[model samples]
Target: MSQDRAAGGRMGDSSLLRRLNHAAALSAFLEADSLTLRELRAVVGVSRPTAEDLLSELLAEGRVEETAPPRQPSEARSAGRPARYFRFRAESGYVSGLDIGAHKAMAVVTDLRGRTLATHRVELDPDLPAPERLQAAVSAARSTWTQAHLRAADITGIACGVTGALRAAEGVHDVREGPFGSSLAPYSLPGFTEIDVAAELSTRLGQPVAVANDVKLAALAEHWKGAAQDHRDIVYMFAGHRAGAGVLIDGQVHQGRHGAAGEIGVFPMLGWETAVARLHARGAVLAAEQGIEPGREGELVITSAARQDPESLAALIAFTEALARGAAVLALAVDPEVIVLGGGMSRGGAIIAEPFRRELAKLTLVPLEVITSAMGADSVALGAARMALDTVITDLLTVPGS
Candidate 1:
């Protein structure tokens, strides 16, 4: 190689290092918007000159702004001038998060700072073809897009949470994998075996799109802003229409080989779904025998009935036992720091938490905290939003040009 070319390649290494440092500084600010020069240097772990150069590059890119006051009081006291404080400009772009299920689809719009701007939901005809349901989901997302006052092209990217396993190889939702139970099929048409979720959304909205398993996204949501926030190892179970689980190992969702890591419900020995079915059956029988109105949701009916009739109460305890059995099995294998109950059944916190925790305590030597989901039905969508936001931010930092 020529001397000039070899020397230029060496210069490129330093240039690349500076670009990486710039991205790191921007990321630090994104985590918590305001920071002083010293604080930025400490967080980014760079020399004073390197930190200043990185910050200057971010400011020039219009990603960082000098603010009047530091968010942390100590930073303000340490740095006399308010101009020393810098904050990330969060409003520069946005992302779309979508949750698609058998019955309905929901969408949430979030800014670069990961704040929800608007949300939209649309019901699907359970008997309708899959393509129609997909269209409905797209329409629902567009409704939120309209609410946010942005065209489809304005979005940086999209993340979608769907009802079945993520076929990463195909970039589609593998609808054949039934997490919601075999009795309940996913929203799909006869002709389409797999829903090309990423391609469809990206085509419809004019941006890159990504897809993930719904339960895993829900677990991610919990880790980000729910009961599992304090714990890195978590087993998050979704016990709504059917029983499903998502595992988090070391602050990351653990989707094992074939994306079937948490298919614990498939083993009938665990008895989580069986217990749920039994509870619903017993509730229906009791309602008919007593001539009382039965609640539509099995979870609500079971939990509410537990407060009344002795049989229903016993069934609730049994349900907890089964749930604990499944959880204990997972805990023994992975030793999660916490186990979270999410989805529809989790809304019945009082009836589920105490018994489940008590039974879990009996089964496992290593005690684990059990709690209900705080996000309710919105967990998957919110988690999808987090993923969407990450892609946008990743591109912002990693791409060659803004």
Candidate 2:
């Protein structure tokens, strides 16, 4: 038994070494564009014999492609000869990213560098049971992945941003009605519980998976590539059918103690309950004053109010003032360098942005730079894809199997 176990250990190490060699060779070939065995060794940090052994394995895997860049002989300053370089055939692999929302889901496929090669979006029933909804979402992703002419094996990692809070300990999230509702039991949603989205998709395609809160993912997207580009500390306020926030401090997301830190929609008196109600009230008043039909529940009648109906305007102003108060509290707590207003309704642009700034100014002595989200309605989804890509890149570069 001991001899057999020892043999198994040796086999495992051999397989791992092969994988590591492939990864290192692939990393150098793709990143450096071309690399010799020595450079591959440096990247892999392995002995020459080990590297050679692994290179043979990679060749068998068809992961490394030999390149014959015209080599020029050195003038022999030290009597040295030129060496051949190799490149990884990364074109052989691909990756996918998915962004799941309450009512919609978006997916994107990209090559190793994160350049988007294809994208897709589909509407979904949020009311569906968690598992079913997740299945629907996964189906959508798979459809899009197929459209992109890529399979699951092409996927290296998946980063997903969910609408609910990702519980700190559970690799899952807790879905609540709002900050005030009964804490729902743990959910088995795709990005939340089963984490099965990745595993299931991996079974279909073969890859690792990662997940994050959609809002936090959006904040990361903005921090890395969008509007909040200038400031390290920022409060990203995303207001839509639902309102929430994402906090970035020193270029990192602060997920709060309960994984609810940026759960601004639940921020005490200013939580989702109060803020959403205020907005709904504004919508109701606008409906009454302008004789316009009431917008659906939780949706503000922005068009009616913006039309300059006196009563509706007053109600809208009041709602804006309440939002300003929420922003003020955020200012006091995080002291974010910039407060970014984003989400669906935020597309009303100055309607919410300018007034929000003025109202915030009235409450606090410290003036804050307030701006609309540059990413707009697609911000969350785009951020989710970016988050997925970030995970794939990180894992490919850092972790062994990923």
Candidate 3:
């Protein structure tokens, strides 16, 4: 019996090693567009036979495929036969992300590499009931996968970004109780904490769904592919209809014990609560002067400021000054490498950047490099897609039946 137990342990050890090798090889392919057998062997630190075996397994699973090697320069080209190459089948599976906000519900379907294949957006009424709002979000996601010409089953992962702070517990109420409740909830949707957002979306979409605060996800998106890609520590501020912040420490998003790490806007003393109102008030005046509808006051103000309208520019400065107050608090606490301004208002370009930076500089001890988001309105959704892609990769690397 002891001999049999020892033999079982040896077999288990061998299986673990094989699994590790398989994961390493697949990870290499995922990182690069393509790889040769020799390169795979070196990357996985395995024998030629083991690399070939791993490749066969991946090929059988349709997660990898043979591809033509790139043509080399005439002088660098070898005289011998060319090496064969294999590439990860990014199209073998898909992932999706959803941004459910007060104004709209946007969804994007991406390949395994987080490339957006299709996106769909639906305008939503903030006053819509919780159940209906969730349905709308799921429908948008479904539309994206359908537009990508893929079935629901083809999507291996899904993540959604929403307005309220998410707790660490699985099904806890997301809405805060006091005056500090979700900023957008009063103006947009109601009773957001009444339902299990992830569970409801998962049930409707027929897949597991990961949910996070929209601002935090926007920060993640910026780090992944936007303005902060070069920086490891960052402060992402969402300056749109509402003001919020997301923090990244050492390249990882910092979610506090309650998953509300960067919620500085909740403090009235911080001035974020009044920032957007100031912008809207200025925008309303600009819209009236321009003879446009009043509801788009924010856009009007931003555009007028860009054109160097004196009143608009002054109002923008005031708005940024208010924004700087909250940002200063975050900067003092985190000391990030950069502060990235994202959201709808960031589209103001230099009109927004200059004042925001000028104001932030006055309030902080260190001169913070403030940049506007290049991702614009799509940052949150793209960030959500990154979250989904991360989930997919995690599952891919995991050994089956482990």
| Candidate 2 per-residue lDDT over residues 338-380, each given as its tens digit | 9887777777766666777888898886888987777744565
Q: Which stretches of candidate 3 lie over 4 Å from their true place?
A: 1-12, 167-175, 178-188, 281-295, 304-315, 399-402
Model 3 lDDT at residue 159: 88
Name the 10 consecutive residues with the lowest summed lDDT in model 3.
180-189
Q: Give the candidates in order of TM-score, highest first.
A: 3, 1, 2
lDDT of 2 at 315: 51
Clashing pairs in 3: 126-188
Q: Quick one: best lDDT, which candidate?
A: 3
- Could you tell me how far off, in angstroms, the CA of residue 74 lies in candidate 3 after the best superposition? 2.2
Model 3 per-residue lDDT tens digits across residues 39-95: 998877677787889999999999999998877789998888889999999999898
lDDT at residue 2 of model 3 (Cα atoms): 33
Better of 1 and 2 by TM-score: 1
Instruction: For model 1, state the Cα shift of residue 219 in Å.
Output: 1.0
Task: Report residue 252 deviation for candidate 1 (angstroms).
Answer: 1.1
How do all models score by TM-score? Answer: 0.81, 0.69, 0.89
Model 1 spans with C-alpha error above 4 angstroms: 1-12, 36-53, 71-82, 167-194, 279-295, 310-318, 399-402
Arrange candidates, best lDDT first. Answer: 3, 1, 2
